[model samples]
Target: MSLPKSRLLVIGCVWPEPNSSAAGSRMLQLLQFFLAENYKITFVTTSARSEFAVDLEKMNITSEVIKMNHPSFDEMLKRISPDLVLFDRFMTEEQFGWRVDEICPEAVKILDTEDLHFLRKTRIEAFKKNIPAEEIYFDADITKREIASIYRCDLSLIISEVEMKLLQKEFNIPQNLLHYLPFLLEPISEEEKLSLPAFKNRKDFISIGNFLHEPNWNAVLYLKEKIWPLIRQELPDAKLNIYGSYPSQKIWNLHNEKEGFIVQGRAENAEIVMKNAKVCLAPIQFGAGLKGKLIQAMQCGTPSITTAIGAEGIAGALDWNGFITNQPKDFAQKAVQLYSEENLWENSAENGFRIINSRFNKEAFQHKLSERLLNLIQNIATYRQKNFIGKMLQHHQHRSTYFMAKFIEEKEKR
Candidate 1:
C-alpha cells in the first residue's frame, strides 16, 4: 500500500516577490521544496499583493486572501484540513496558529522563522545603543513572544547555523525543536562562471537590498557618510549603485550624481545588475541570518567588501569572497583593492563557490528536510510528549490570545 499524499497550508505574511528581497526568494525556495516533494500547497496570505509579488497561480499553486481575527479563516482552514500548516514567520503563526490548533488538533504545526526576529531586534538595539555584545540579553518583549511561538510549534526552521547555536546555547531551546535549513542551491557550473562578466570587464561597486529593512538602510547611510568618502577618494569615477524595493522619499534624497553616489531604486533585474558590477558593498552594522545580497554577489562572480556582521554564517572556515572588516577605512580600502586586482577577485569568487557547494547543496538539504518531516508525521505524538514546555506555552498562549482575538473580532463586527 502507498502512503497518502500530504497537504500543506502556508500562511504567509505577504505575497512573495523573489526579485524584490531575499526573504521573498527564501519563501519561494521553501514553496518549491514542497512542490518538488509532491506536496499539495495552498498559500494563503492576509496581506495585500504588491506589484512585484510573484503570481502563485502561474506556478499552479493555489492561493487565498485571509483576514486576521476573523471567524472566516477557521472555516477555510477546516475545509482544506491540511496535514501540515507552515507559518511564514512567528507573526503569522501568532495570528492564525490558535485557530489551526483548535480546528485541527492533529495537523502538524511548522514555523519557518525566515530569520530569528528577536535576534535581529536585539542586534538592532545594540547597534543603536552602542552596547557591548556580552551585555545583550533576552530581556526584550519580542524575545518572549518569538520564543513562545517557537515552542508552540512542532518544528521551527532556522535558516542559519549561528542562530541554531544561539537558541540552543543561550535560550536552551531543545535541538529537536529546531532544524537548520540554509538557502538551498545547486553549485554553479564552469560554463556559468565563464558567462559572468570577467573581473577586468566589470566596473563600479554595487549594493542591493530591500530598503524597508532598517539594517540595509543603515548600511547605505554608513556607506554614504563614512565608508564612501574614502572609496570615492580612491576611485573618483566609480559609482555606488544602491538598488532595492520600495525606496522612500528619504532614500531618493541621498542620490547625488556629482558625488558618484547613485540611489537607483528597485532594480528590474537584480542579478543582471550584480553580474555587471565589479564589487558589492554591504557594510552591515547589525543584522542576523545569512546576507542574501552577499550570496547573490558570490553567485554572480562579484566579490564584495562587507563587515564581519555582513559576512557572518555565510563564510564558515573558508576565505571570504572579498574582504571582511568592521572599520570604515579598511572596508573602503579593501573594496578598492578587490576592484583593481583581477587575481584577488578570481580567488575570492572561487572561495564563494566552495562555500555554496559544501554548505548549501540543494539536493542534500532537501533530502534531510523531507526525512525530518516524515519522521515528525509518524511520531508527532511522541515528539509533542518530549516537548512538555511547548505544550505548556501553547496551552497558555492559546487561552490568552484566543480571548484577545475574540475581543478584536467582536469590535470589528460592531
Candidate 2:
C-alpha cells in the first residue's frame, strides 16, 4: 500500500506580504520549511487579498478563503483533516482553534505568535503616555486570552529568546510548549559580504519598515520630533531617509527636503536600498519580537544605531551591529559617528553578520523543528496529557468560544 501524503493547514491573519512587513517575511520562511519537507500545505485566511500579498499558488501552496465564526469552517476542517494546523496569530487561534480541536482532534495545533501582542500593546501605551513600560502586567484581558491560547496549543513558535524566557519565567508556560524560532536565515558568505556596498560607496542614514505597524510609525515620529534634529545639527550635510510600505498622508506630511528628513515611502527594493545606505537608524521606543529592518541592515552590510527596545532578542550576548541607546541625544550622536567613522561602521556591520550566523542558522533550526514535530506526532496523547492546564483551557474555553461563535453565526444568517 502507498503511504499517505503529509498535510499541513495554516491559518493566517493576513495574506503574506514579504515586501510589506517582517511578519509576512517570517510566514514565508515558515512556508519554505514545509515546502522543503514536501508537505502538502493549504493556507486559509478570512482577510481579503491585497495587491502586496504574496501569490502562494505560484509557490505551490494552495490558499482558500474561509469565513470567521461559521459552520462552513468546521466542514472545511473535516474535509482537509490536516496532520498539523498552524495559527498565524493569537486572534486567529481564538476564532478557529475550537473548531480545529473539535474537528481534527489528532492534528498538532501550533500557534506562531509573531510577537507577544500584549507586550507590544503595553509598550505602545507606556510610550505614548511618556512612562516606563514596566507599568504593563500579565493580568490584562489580552494576556489572559493569549496565554490560554498558548497553553491549549500543542506548541507555540516564539520569535525571540527573550519572549521564550518571558513565557517560562513570567507566565509559567512549559519549555516543551514554546520554541524559540527566530528568522530562519541562511548564513552570509564572505563573498556576499564583500559584494555589499563598501563604507565609502554608501551614503545617507536610512530607516525602513512597514508604516502600517504602529511601532514603525511611532519610530518615525520619534525620529522627526526628538532624534533627527539632534543628529542633523551636528552633521548638517547628511540626510535621514524614512522608507516604508503603505505610508499614509500623515507620514507624507512629515517629509521636508529642506531639513533633509526625507520621508521616502515604500521601498521599490528593500535589499537594494539597504545596501546603498551608509547607516540604518531604528530608534524604536516600543514593540515586541525582533525588528526585520535591523536584520536586513546587517544582511546588507550596513551598521545601525537603535535603542535597547530595537536591539531586543536579536543581539543575544554579542555586541550590537552598531549601538543601542535609549537616550535621544546619544542615539543621534551615535548615528553621526556611525555614518562618518568607517572603522566603526565596518566593525558594526561585521558584528551583524556574526549575530545572524550564530543565532539564526536556518538549516539547524529546520532540522531541530522537524525532529520535534516527528516526536510530537508519535506521542500526541502523552504530550497532551503532560499539559494538564492546556486540557483544562481546551475543555472550558472551547465550549464558551464555540457557543459565542454559533450565536454570531446564527445572527448573521438571520
Candidate 3:
C-alpha cells in the first residue's frame, strides 16, 4: 500500500558528512527538524563518499543513491511520491527541478541554498585585488540559474539574512518565496561551558577549515605569507597549527614543524582540537553564509580573530568573541594580545557562547520554522497566486531549463 503523504525527500548534491563540511552539518540539522515534526525523510544523493557520512540507519532515515545527469532519478522520485521535496542546493534544483515538477506536481518543492555561490565568488574576486565597478555589475551566469531554480521551487530556505535582503532589494524576489533560516543549534549549557578546557589550559594558535573550499585555502595562504611572519616576530615561541580535511601536496609542503607552522590534515575531532587551542584564526578574506569554524570555536570556548568579511552577518547585534581585522600587522598584533591576556580571551570566549545561544539556538527557532513551513504548505495556492513573477520565471524555465536538461539527457544516452 502507498504510504500517506507525510514523507520529505531531500535531494542532496552529496551525502551528509557533518565533520567534513558546514553544508553537511546543515543538511543533518534539517533532517532532524523534519524528524521532530514527525515526517519520514528520504535522503537522496549522487556523489560517492567513503569518509565521514551521517549514519542514516541510526537516525531511522532511508538513503538512496541517484544517478547524475540521467533520467533514472525521475523513476526513483516517482516511486517515492513525497509530500515535500527539498533540494540541498541550487545545482541540485537545476538538475532535478523539471523532473520533480513532472513526477510529483503536488509535492511542495523547497530549495535550501547552503550559501549564495555568486556572492562567494564575487567577494573572492574583489578580495583578490582592487574590486572594479564592472566586476560587481558583470553578469554572473550562476545567479540566473540559481534564481530560476528558486522560482521553480515553492520556497527557498535562505541561510543568510544578508542574502535574503539582497534577493529582495536587488532582485526584487517576493518575500513569500524566500525564508531566512540559520544553523539551528542547541544552546550550550552552563555545565557544558564549565567542563570545557579553560583558556589557560589550552595553548597555541590554530586555523582550521575544510580544504575543499578555495576561500579557506586562500586564508591559509594569507596566514603563511603575510600574517604568520608578523605574528612570529612578536611571539617567536607561538606555534600555528593549520587543521583541515583534504590537504593537497601543495598544502603539505607548507608544514614547518621546526618553524612552529604545522599543517595537520583532517582532524579526527574538530571540537577536541578547538578546545585544546587557545585561539582560532580565520582570516577568510571572502565567503558567504556563516563560517562553521568560527561557530565551533565559540562552542568550544576558543576565541577567534577573523577578517570583517569572515565575520559577516554571523553574530547579528551581539559582540564578536574575538577581533575582526583585515590588516596583516594589526591581525598578528591582536593575535598576540588575545593569546597573552587571560581576561581578554575569557571575555571574548564568553561573548561567543552568548552569540551562539542567542543567534543559532535550535530550540529557539524550531517552532517558528515549523509554523512557517505549515503556512507555506497550507496556503501554497494563494502564495503562488500572489507570486506572479515566480510564475512567469517558472514558465520561462520550463521552456529553457527543460529543453537544456533534455538535450543533456539525450547526449548522455548517445
Candidate 4:
C-alpha cells in the first residue's frame, strides 16, 4: 500500500504572476518541485488576485484567499495540518509565522527569500545619495526584521550566492540555516542552439523586465538618460526596444522613433522578443538577486551587456555571456561590438549555454532541495535543538506578534 502524501502549505505575499515577474517564476518552480515530491500543496495569500496571476488549480494545486489579523486563519491551519509551511518572503513570515507556530507546532517552516530586501533597499538608497552601494549601512531596521525572520525559520532559501555569503560572513548567520538555490533551468542542447536564429537574422538591442520592479524602472531611466545616447552615436540606425510589464506613462513617454529608442510595454511573448534581438542591454545601477531578463536572453541565444551588480552570483567563475561594465560609454561600445561582430556574438552565446548548464542544472538543484527538506522533516526536533537562537526568537515573536494581531482583530470587529 502507498503511504499517505505529505501536506505542504505556502503563504504568499501575492499570487504568482509568472508572465510578469521573476519572483512569480521562482515560486512556481518551488511549487512544481513540491508537487513532484507528491506533496498535497495549498497556497494562500492575503493580497487581492491579479488577472496576470497563474492558475494554480490547473496545476493541481489548491489556492485560497486569506485575511490578516484574523483568527479564522488559525482554524484553517489546524484543519490543513501541514507537514511543511513555506513562506513566500520575510514579510509573509512576519505576518503569519506566529499563528502557524501556534496552530501547527510540528510543521517545518521555510522561507524562500526571493531576494534580500534589505540589501536591495540599502543599495538603492546609496545610489540616490551618489554614494557607493558598498558603503551603505547594513544594520537598518529592515535588515534587522528580515534577519530575525530568517533566524525564526528552520531554513531560508537564498536566491543568490553573493547574498548567502553576506548572510554568513557579514551578518554571521549560521550556514545550516541557509540554502543557495538560484533559477532552476533546463540544460540547452546542441539541437536547441542550432534552432535559434543566427546573428544575421536577429537585429536591434532589446531590454525587457517587469517595470513594477524599481530596478528595472531605474535601468530604463538610466538607458534613456545615459547609455542609449552613447549607443545612438555609434549606430544611429540600430534601435533599442524596451519591453516590460506595467509601464507607467513616464516610461511610455521615453519612446522616440526618431532616436531609435522604442518603449514597447508588456511583452506578450518574452521568449520570442528575446530570441529576435541581437543584443540585450541591462544597465542596472542597483538591485539584488538573479535577473530573469538576462537569463531569458541567454536561453534565447542572445548575448547581453550588464553591470557588475546585474551579473552578480549568476556567472560564478565562468566568463559572462557578453560584457560586464558600469560605465555608460563602455557599455554602449560593448553593445555595438556584440551586435555587429557575428563571431564574438556567437562565442558569447556559447558562454551563456555553458553558464546555464554548469551552474543552474534543474535536476541537480531539485535533488539537493529534496534531500535537504527530507532531512529537515526527519530531524526537525534535533535541528530546532541546535538552533537555540531560532527557538528564542520564536518564543518572543509569538508573544509580541500574537497580542498585536489580537488587538488589531478586536479593533476591526468593534
**Clashes per model (N, Cα, C within 3 A):** 0, 0, 1, 0
Regions of candidate 3 where Cα sits further than 4 Å from its true position: 1-5, 132-134, 411-414
True lDDT of residue 121, candidate 1: 84
- Candidate 1, residues 230-277: lDDT per residue as tens digits? 988988998999998999999999899999999999999999999999
Q: All predictions: root-mean-square deviation over Cα?
A: 1.4, 1.9, 2.5, 1.6
Model 4 lDDT tens row, 206-274: 999999899999999999999999888989899999999999999999999999999999988888999
Give every collision pair in model 3.
185-362
Q: Which one is best on lDDT?
A: 4
- lDDT by residue (1-414, candidate 2, tens digit) is 111338899999999999889999999999999888788899999998888888999999999889998899999888889989999999998888889989998889999999999888888888778876666655578788899899999999999998998889988888999888999999999999999989999889998999889999989999999989998899999898899999999999999998999999988889999999999989898899999999988888999988889999998899999999999999988888888889988999999999989988998999888877777877889999999999999999888998899899989999
Tell me the whole-model lDDT of each prediction, alpha carbons only.
0.90, 0.90, 0.86, 0.92
State which candidate, 2 or 3, has the greater lDDT. 2
Give the Å error, residue 205, model 1.
Answer: 0.5
Superior candidate under lDDT, 1 versus 4: 4
Residue 410 displacement in candidate 4 (angstroms)? 0.7
Give residue 305's lDDT in candidate 3 (0 to 100).
Answer: 97
